[model samples]
Target: MSTTHEVTNQVPPLVGHDVAEDPALLEALRREGAGWAEPELHEVGRLAGSEQAQEWGRVVNENEPVLRTHDRYGNRIDEVEFHPYWHSLMDVAVEHGLHGAPWADSTPGAHVARAAKLFVWGQVEAGHTCPISMTYAVIPTLRANPELAAQYEPLLTAKTYDFGLRVPTSKQGLIAGMSMTEKQGGSDVRANTTRATPAGDGTYRLVGHKWFTSAPMSDIFATLAQAPGGLTCFLLPRVLPDGTRNRMHIQRLKDKLGNRSNASAELEYDEAVGWRLGEEGEGVKVILRMVNNTRLDCLLGSAAGMRFGAVQAIRHARHRSAFGSVLVEKPLMRNVLADLVVESEAATVVAMRLAGATDRGEEILRRIGLAVSKYWVCKRAPVHAAEALECFGGNGYIEDSGMPRLYREAPLQSIWEGSGNVAALDALRAMARQPETVEAFFTEVERASGADARLDDAIEGLRKELSNLEDMEFRARRVVESMAMVLQGSLLVQHGAPSVADAFCASRFAGDWGVALGTLPSGVDTKAIIERALV
Candidate 1:
């Protein structure tokens, strides 16, 4: 055979570089009082960037989870079968305290540290993080019932990864899932028609169908049903006490757009025994705690995707030759790569700031700021991923390049907790009901005063937009997007490198940007911004 088809001009695999070598993330970690965790953060970062870990991400996605709804004897046995690599990913995540462990830690910056770890590990595979995020989110909601929290909190936060259908209490650790959406009431949990009847002995029997229940293989679930008082939150175990399975029935696993390594099932509860969490008629209030934590994950996940995409594009541009020059050296390609780097840095900055809010117990900011970031950052992920993938030209379009996987996973976080409209409205509602949250939001935004003139102007514009409640409902998306960018600008000005900050403000706030990604105005130090994307 002729050796005529030897591959040339092919970009080498992106491996060995520490994924946690992200300057923005490390700076934010040190700035947020979690500098002590830096050693472990790099450890996780190294593992995440290893060729083995990257292969794990690829294998699991290519081999999607399969639903095993019955046994050979035709008995109904609800289960999801995943590739063994799924367990490997989940094992590292739990051991690193990226799941529920941070809630149990007494350290000042425990949550911030965990946030950094999750950001690093999630780049390995985003799908498995669904369960990890749910486990972390459920711990806070479980506290609504002290007794329930006492029983399961230990297992939820345990480092051991116990994967099975055994009784949750018997396991050394447990993974948690959220089963809230119904066929009819997607985000409107109050409209859920699932009914729950008190079973005389401190338990309730639930009867309903959940349209989307992710991580169905997990042992425990935080679900919502209509109690007699009103819609209420409940904790349902896949395996009940005395080694018996609950009445929870798996209807079928959903065929989703992405996140294939994770299982999302349509489920039915036929008088499933569950214990009520919090008071009756307060399900929405109780479950919102979990939603808040998970929304933070949504922001972090989006930021990670951006970082992954930017780094990949830059890595490709550095080595690949195009039009008689390397892509990174080309003027237009340099601008585009720098733009992606700036966006990724901005996202990491805001994400760490929000995680810092959680660590410091800044409830007001976490409540409102989270909604705004969830609305804007998650929405930006898909567009950012698309631009990053295009940097590789036709190579990025193919599945083997792994750019397609990043592109596929980009849009998931936006639709996970609440879609675009739901998130925007939530922020507006928070501002109307809890006025202090608005004060908290602005207070945080004002910290970067005198840092960037365009940011200052944008803040004033946002204030004017929020001042008028007239037609606010119609302008909810507009208001939230403005708030999101202003907050990102403020954080970048205060915490990010001057090059990243200057480029971000120039392109994002000064109106110098265009509809596409590479449209950064000239003189924006593209080389400095692009350099930060490398190890």
Candidate 2:
């Protein structure tokens, strides 16, 4: 038998016309819009009572599960075993979503925001690594290892009333990080030098130092390595089968500019026991999925930071009396406040659209949405933060005042979870696979934008911008800009319209108003009936 098999897989070329023209989907989107402004947040808090805030506040008040405190010479302070605040928050988050808690949709995204703010408050604002670990390390491990699930199910499922980081937080766990960035090599996972060799007895040995492992103290490490086939992922347990220490050695923790508190470790793997995830050459594929989810986290974090910074500036502007009036009273400062609102809300809306795509089980769409949302929000965080900080004047530069932390942490947004460049490349690749999706995305926006007076002008402005996308260079620019436009339209129609007609409106927007129809050379409204809900 041949070890190599030619797998001719068809992705069924996705066209923007199909989704943009989905009448039913648009109708559903329109119907969903009526309740767009429905006070889900207050309602959830009121219904859940202290339970909602209590669980969430733990993440806000306490430090996360993994802590990275270093000494004078940059030596890592060995695991201090802080109370498990981050874990408690995760427990609450899982329960909230599982039971369809009132703010279920909002809770996950909101909790992420709360976690980022809390990190900001602790001055360890830079140590925002738990969210990625929870998604990449914790969730995937639970899916792969039922034994571990059996051990931790209670924690993951149980409803907790207590607040702050809980203690005695022990469970079969997995922690994930990256090693793609090397001294010579960049984030090209395909070029990773980490090697793993089968050690017989269903175990394998991993040898090679990874450049960066975010949460170093995790019991299991979802580390990537290279083999005879191609890039692959391994469940590198921190301990051996006998529960003794494995050869997974930590060389040193990185002294990064921001996210300083999240100890990013450089690891040396010496014949570590590792279980293969999927096929030997398929690690990149599996990890890419995991990374997409992380990108969502990154967007959520960027939004949270923007929200926090905005909140800080608003508070100061309203309270601080400058030039005989509050900072917010000055027209210039007020304009800054308005800018913060727009930027922050824009990011929030994009994040929400990505979340909605995920909730709807559109995995392909979800990846694109996640990529765009991450790029958009993370890119805008610095802009919003700097503006907010400028409003603070000299106070923004002071460390104790909180503005400086946001300034310091804002840049990290563009660096993590597949940086902006990486995200751009991946997004382009996805668009190439589903060329029509780009068009569908925009057409829906145009349809929605044409209807809404508040958004029509902006939509029209964007339309003119895309008109230049006729030639190859223009098409290149159009692809990126068009991606953003579709996302904006999706968000506006998804969240801005009235709730009762959410589905309808969204479908209509997709079909007649989207950029997909305008941009695709071979345009076809495949889902027009669904978009119109005419059937």
Per-model TM against the reference: 0.99, 0.68
Q: What is the C-alpha lDDT of each candidate?
A: 0.92, 0.51
Predicted structure with the largest lDDT when compared to the true one = 1
lDDT of 2 by residue, 351-404 (tens): 555555554455666656666666666877787778778766787776646566
Candidate 1 on 51-74: residue-level lDDT in tens?
A: 999999999999998888889999
The segments of candidate 1 whose C-alpha lies over 4 angstroms from its true place after superposition are none
What value does the lDDT take at residue 443 in candidate 1?
Answer: 93
Q: Let me know the TM-score candidate 2 reaches against the reference structure.
A: 0.68
